[model samples]
Target: MLSLRTRGKSGIYYIRGSVSLNRQTIDVKEFSTGTSDKDAASHVMAQYQMQLHNELLFGPTAKVADVTFSPEM
Candidate 1:
């Protein structure tokens, strides 16, 4: 499931979620939707979630994400 949260006081929204495949869980990191507006952010986040779903189901044929956030090592 995907969820949105405000980033500090910036008014910007970010997405976070997790998906499971073959009993393996993938934790999607928080990703910026690049918009402060909740409605716009939700739209963008839905697209992203769909992309992820397609890729997982269709074996990488889906479009790749432009931005990926991984914790700095």
Candidate 2:
């Protein structure tokens, strides 16, 4: 998976992901924010949302995230 911002004043954003299956590749592309500098939180949230949506829409069954955080990390 890769995410990047567009050049110049476009302020456009792009996201790319690829999965290989059955000796073939399936690619997914999406855009969220325009070419702008995104804070870390926004970028993370964007990726999280995309993954969740893709799972619900394309997978056999959607699984919710069970996230855990620790100070020791």
Candidate with maximal lDDT: 1
Per-residue lDDT, model 1, residue 58, is: 64
Total clashes in model 1, counting residue pairs 3 or more apart in sequence or in different chains? 0
Model 1, 11-70: lDDT tens per residue? 889999886667556578999898899999999988878777766776644555444789
Q: What is the C-alpha RMSD of each candidate to the true structure, in Å?
A: 7.7, 7.9
TM-scores for all candidates: the values are 0.73, 0.39
Candidate 1, run of 10 with poorest lDDT: 58-67
Leading candidate by TM-score:
1
TM-score of model 2 vs. true structure:
0.39
